[model samples]
Target: MFYSSSWSKCLICLIFITSGNAECPKPQVEGNFVLTNDALLKNDFPEGTEATFECANGYLKEQGSERITCTSGEWSTLELTCKKKDCGAPRKIAHLTYEFGEEGTLFGASAKAICDKGYQLMGSSYRQCYANGWSGRPRCEVVTCEKPIEIKNGTITEQPDKEFPEYGGVIQYSCDEGYTLIGNKSIECNEDGEYNSVPPECKDGNDIPLKPTTTISTTSITTTTTSTVPPIIRDVDDIPLKPTTTISTTSITTTTTSTVPPIIRVSGRNNGIGEHDTNAATGNAAVVGSVIGTVIVTLIVLFTLYRFYKRKGSYQTGEDPSRKEELLQFKNN
Candidate 1:
C-alpha cells in the first residue's frame, strides 16, 4: 500500500512536467507590424519564450513595448501600436507652396500646390506621400506670352526686349511708310499669359477696304425722300400699301440708295458689323408690323365704343365705359 501511494505521486509529478514543457502554436503581428524574421521562421515557441516585432514599411512604432512573452502554451498580448511615418516637406521652389490634407505629410497623404500671383503652375499641382518618398516635383513659373507673329510691311513698336512678354506688358505696332495698321493701335498682355488680341496686320494704303453701302426701302402716298435716323435704328424694307378699294390697273415704283458710315471700328473686337445675320431684318419687320397692328386695334376699339354707347347705352350695371376708353387711348399712345 505504501508502494502504490508512491507511484501515484510520481505520475502526478510527470504530468506537471509535461504540461510545463508545452509549446505555443505561433505569434502573429497585425497588418501594420510584423514579427521578426527569426520569430516567424520557428513556430515551436516553447512556454516562456520571447518574440520581438518590427513595424512594416511606411509605418512607425507609436506606443508600448514591441516585445511579447509566450506563456502557458499561448502567446501573451502585444501592446505595440503603429502609426504612419511622415515624409516631411519636399524641396522648395520659387513662388510655390503646399497645403496638406487631414493626414498631413504622413504616408499615403496628399498636399495641394499653390502659386503666387502673376505666376503659373508648371508641373503637377499635387504631391503624394508614398512608401519611398513624396511623389512629384511640382513647380511654379512666371507668366509669359509667345512673341508676336511677324507682319509684312509692319514693325512692332515699344516691344519688350525679352523673347516672351510678361503679364501686363504693353506693345505698340506701327507700319512702314506706305503701309497702314489694320487693327488696334496696341496689344497688351493679359493675366492669361497671352495678348488681349491678335497682332494687327500691315496692309498697303491702297489695299484698304472701302466703306460699305446701305440701302433702305419705304412707301409714301404722294412722294418719298431719303432721310437719316439714329445709327442704332437699322434700315427697313419697303412695306406694301393696300388701298381701301381694289384697283386692277395701278402699280407702284420704289427705289433706295444709301452710304453706310464706317463699320470697321479699330477696337479689335466685334462691333455688330462682321458676320451676316437675319436678326436685324427680323427685328425691323416686327417693329413695323407691331405699329400697324396697334393702329388697327385703336380704330377697332373706337368703333366698338361708338356702337356700345349708341345701341346698348350703359356699360352693364355701374361699370364706367369712359374709364375703359381712357385706358385704351393710353395704351394706343
Candidate 2:
C-alpha cells in the first residue's frame, strides 16, 4: 500500500506539469486589429499554435508582422500595428480647386471642388476617398457665349468669323457712310451666354430736309440840273430889241446798283429758286441806261451856247425877216 500511494502522487505531479506546459499565455492585439485565420477563441492557446493578424474596416497594417506563434507557455510578441488607410492626394482638375474635410485623404474622407471664374463644374461637386482611390473625378469647363447677331448697316469689329464667343469677349460696331449710329458702339459677352448691352443700329442721314434759297436786288437813281444864261445879240437900227434869249441846261446823274446771290437755309423740306433768280440781273441793267441819257443832254447844251457867242457880230447889222426866220427854223431842228 505504501508503494502504490507513492506512485499515485508521482503520476499526479507529472500530469500537472504536462498541463502547465501545453497552454500558452494570451496574445495582445492592437485596437482596430483582429486575428485572421484563427479558430480558437479561448484566452489561452496551445504551444506551437500560429495565427495571422489583420486590421478592421478602414485600418491597414503598418510596419509589423502579420503573424504570431505560441511557444514555451507564452505567446510571441504581438508586433502587428494598424494605421488608417490613405488614398493619397486628390486628383488634379483643370480650372478647378479642391478643399479637404477634417478627415483629409484618408479612407471615407470627403473633398469638394470649386470652379474658377468664367468656368462651370461638371458632375458631383463632392468626392470621397475609398479603397480603390478617389471617387469619379469632377471636371471644369470654360463658359461660352452665343454668337452675336449682325447689326443693320454695321459690322462687328473683331472675331467676326467665330461661331461662338467666349465669356468677357468684346464686340465693336461701326456704321457705313450716310448712316448714323443710334446706340452703344460696343457690347461684351457675359457668363450667361448673352451680351451685356443691346446691339446698335444705323439710321439714315437724309431724314431731315434743306430749306430753299432766296435772292434780292436794289437800284437807286439821282439827277442834278443847272441853268446858264447865253450871250445876247443887238440890232444896229438903234432899236433896243429884247436880246434873243438863249437857254443852256446842264444835268448830272448818279446811279447805284446792287446784286445779291441766293442764300440757302436748312428747314423741314428741300426747296430752290428757279426762274426768280434772273430778276436780280435785269434790275442792274436799267440803272446803267439812265446814267448814259443824262450825259448826252449835258454835251448838247454846251455846243449851243458857244455858237451863239460867235454869231453875235453878224446879227448886229440889219435884221432880215427871211434870214431870221431861217435861223430860227434851223435852231429848232
Give the alpha-carbon lDDT of every model.
0.71, 0.71
Runs in model 1 deviating more than 4 A are 1-15, 114-125, 141-144, 164-169, 177-180, 189-194, 202-333
> Poorest 10 consecutive residues of model 1 by lDDT?
226-235
Model 1, global lDDT: 0.71
Which has the greatest TM-score? 1
Q: For model 1, how does the per-residue alpha-carbon lDDT over 171-280 read when each residue is reduced to its tens digit?
A: 88887776668898789888788889988888765556656545454432222222222112211322222223322222223222222232343222222224333345
TM-score of each: 0.52, 0.49
Worst 10 residues of 2 by lDDT: 267-276
Off by over 4 Å in 2: 1-30, 37-45, 69-77, 206-333
Candidate 1 structure, TM-score to reference = 0.52
